[model samples]
Target: MAVAVNAAVTLPSSKTSSSPSIRFSSIAPERIAFSKGVGYLKNGLVTGGKAASIRAQVATETPTKVVKESKKDDEGVVVNKFKPKNPYIGTCLLNTKITADDAPGETWHMVFSTEGEVPYREGQSIGVIADGIDKNGKPHKLRLYSIASSALGDFGNSKTVSLCVKRLVYTNEQGEIVKGVCSNFLCDLKPGAGVQITGPVGKEMLMPKDPNATIVMLATGTGIAPFRSFLWKMFFEKHDDYKFNGLAWLFLGVPTSSSLLYKEEFDKMKEKAPENFRVDYAVSREQTNENGEKMYIQTRMAQYAEELWELLKKDNTYVYMCGLKGMEKGIDDIMVSLAARDGIDWLEYKRQLKKSEQWNVEVY
Candidate 1:
């Protein structure tokens, strides 16, 4: 007998705008509609949306249990160890531009010296408070960024944390050049500069415990932060307790070849573990599909939809998406008909996967 469950998961609120709303149904599961943008699922609970902003609402009913259980399994996972009012003061160790000078925008890779004061996992995020007061006369709020280094840190000493940030500068309708406060502040930091840091927070994007699991990662631009942590742990570092023997396939989307983040590292990993690792890029500006269409991530993914669907059927396979909220709709468009051909409801199947902790998404 099959049991039907219907629930709604609210995402976290963001300063930017309203969070995405999610509702699950067994009878007639509607396509996930975003009030403003799409929401993200940590375990089974849909908390927030977007990669740049942290906007999650509360979970209700059975989804709440799923959140609790996921947290229980992550024993000793730190959260909010440093608050905005009393943040841990850390020093900048390195700040370098990872993108090309002529690329669409400036993206920076920065390392902060935690010195073991901040303990964080692979998929967690850290909040950064810029040193200034806002026009409202209050301190600038902390902005959360996904951790780009593994638990062992970039130097493998467990004494540092890293982040991949894109300097946000855009022109408003008034023709004024406005810069993102936190982003510009962090980007221009000198070595030894003090930083106010908060929370090694979030459990939604954590790596699976299975060493032999088939991990499929989809990321765009700076959203590759958490995936970098996972890949480093899987390929670069050696652990006595964990030895990964399964496959890790990554599908990265970017505007151009130069915009691809961590390309050299990913290429090295692919070279080192040819059998266990695979990577495909959707360089929208540089590539075109068979139909002569601009190759966005989904169009690139559609090329492997059959094979991907087959992998999705396996119990050990997990799918993780982290990037723009718009990517969700593109992925769904690819999977919907393929799932229908087999008389399966892709959304419901995805919900089941979420219930089993297999489908993890953290999109912005």
Candidate 2:
């Protein structure tokens, strides 16, 4: 991440350095008029008399309240309402395994009773602090999990928040079994069990307000969390303020068909809105793509590369990716050649999409 410094400075002309002169066409003429000695600069040096005049002009012209007002209009994106030092104690309402018993690992769908105390939007995450102390003699650190339910929640009420968690259990180099403290705690949770929770953090994966916009979701494993929330809002629920009339296409990758999460719910959604929803599964072990290659998300996506590229070219299309960070590289590889077909630079195009908030990513 790059930290932006807010300090303002006037650089000397290109004659002072080996670099060529660069023009900043976006800067307003009046703002840089100081270079002509009308304000602060006098022969590349700040003049006290002119500096005060420029400061007065800036103070009167700049919109000091723009940032504050923009935040106020931001559709209520909630953040850390509960902190680690003082976390919210909520009760688990339900904890049921969603994955098949014979699947590679255990994945559970748990809903916590917030009782309207902990408000959250879709695509946000909650932090869970496990009950026990760690080897360092300190309390276990909280683990963040993506919220699986919409703002209306799993019960179609605002009192609950849900999560999709995969239990982490593995053998260490010493041949000892190790389990993830927070994940195991969440997975084994029973109804009425108290859970220490914090945060409804993150804004990157928030759904766009454009109700008719096309949504392209790419997920792997439990990365399906946020997308499930989005799909529920788009298909299963009805809102007086919002209606999704456009397309939502999902590509989910998993090791086996049995590991597919929320299969029944997604199937029902597709049945209800057949024209508006489409789903593709990439089961690496059971499915193969064209040319007999193991079916992965990117490979399945490659089948519709042309159609996807066209949709991506539209202003109302949004692509969201969440899962393992390596999935990004696979997507980039798929898009590179397709973008080149139209003489476009894929990286630069993707950057513009990000700048416009059209391409959203939340991968670990």
Candidate 3:
């Protein structure tokens, strides 16, 4: 089952000069109607209208499990035994956890682990099955979180995948706390609690197998997960044999330097792979420009438009992005502007890149 959440902001009639903003909750299982951005409850009671179909296919399919040796005899032959693996079992590995706060009420990073070999690619993510009940007496929900650790952190694909999680806190219709299910569960885990998990999903954010391809990574907030994996697979694993053909360019943005994830690791990479790795950090809420203005990744890209064009024109360059949904438009505009300057049509560049699998994105 799913629940639909809708939020809309309205000003007083006297102060209603500006347009309102509306957002939907992807977490819900039911369809909700917003009449002029106002939502009303209709639980099995029709409001003089037909309802949308509630039956829909979900893409995030869970892996099926099979039962093993449940009815084995002394000689190992079973008698009428056929059972699927239970869907509710998982292990706990990381007991003593660490918590760090970079944002006041927005994001928090939770570090934990589960026993067993959880192998995953550099760009994959895991779905967490949190164990707890909500205030409504419902079991806590499952959530997919991008793995932030490098492939090296996987310990030959047997270790845990470190996760960087963001907490979502909102108020309910009754002015009560409506916390995010998985985020708060992760944040509140004690030393011995267990967390069920499935995955290592996603294919679009993977690193290139060819060593000679250049990598351009664009990310914002916790979207840095896959790039961390890519970097480790390249530099940490020493995949650059004869000559590293790719120059790794990373463009990351956050509200402030303090909110930037993996700062220490990126700094270390800067010192080690100084020639191949280029980093540009856009701290939007602090450190104003010379004209006293804030900056973002798109703004920084504009500042380096010439170099960006050169890199994009490279023969085997791969561009990967994971971040907020609307930021892609800004990136597209910049790329189109550059394409126009280069005497090339925006559609040509877009189609060419799509044909070569050079353009990839994972936005939420």
Each model's backbone clash number: 10, 0, 6
Better model by TM-score: candidate 1 vs candidate 2: 1
Cα deviation at 47, candidate 2, in Å, is 36
Q: Candidate 2 residues 1-364, lDDT tens each?
A: 1111121324335464211122332232222211111111000011245433332332323323211121123757778999999999999866666777578998877778798888887778999999989999999888999998888766555777889899999999999999988899998887679999999788888887778778999999999999988987887666788889999999999999879988777776778789999999999999998699999899899999988987876656789999989889988999999777776777877876775567899988
Give the Å shift of residue 238 in candidate 2. Answer: 1.5
Expressed as tens digits, the lDDT of each residue in 151-254 for candidate 1 is 87765667789999999999999999999999999988866799999998898888888787899999988889999889888887767888889999999999
TM-score of each: 0.81, 0.80, 0.68
The TM-score-based order of candidates, best leading, equals 1, 2, 3
| Poorest lDDT segment (10 consecutive residues) of candidate 3 | 50-59
Best by TM-score: 1
Better of 1 and 2 by lDDT: 1
* 1-364: candidate 3 lDDT, tens digit per residue: 1123333433324444222333444423222222222221111100112110100111123323322121111232211121112222344322211123345354433334433345555677777767767689876556777876554343323344567666678888999987787877775554346776666566656665556677889898878878876765555443333235568899998887657766655666667679888899988887566666678777777778777766666435678888898778888787787667655665556655544456788889
Model 3, position 230, has a per-residue lDDT of: 79
> Which of candidates 1 and 3 is the stronger one according to lDDT?
1
Candidate 3: C-alpha lDDT: 0.57
Off by over 4 Å in 2: 1-75
The best-first sequence of candidates by lDDT reads 1, 2, 3
Q: List the residue pairs that clash in candidate 3.
A: 2-28, 2-29, 3-28, 3-29, 4-28, 65-85
- Which candidate wins on lDDT? 1
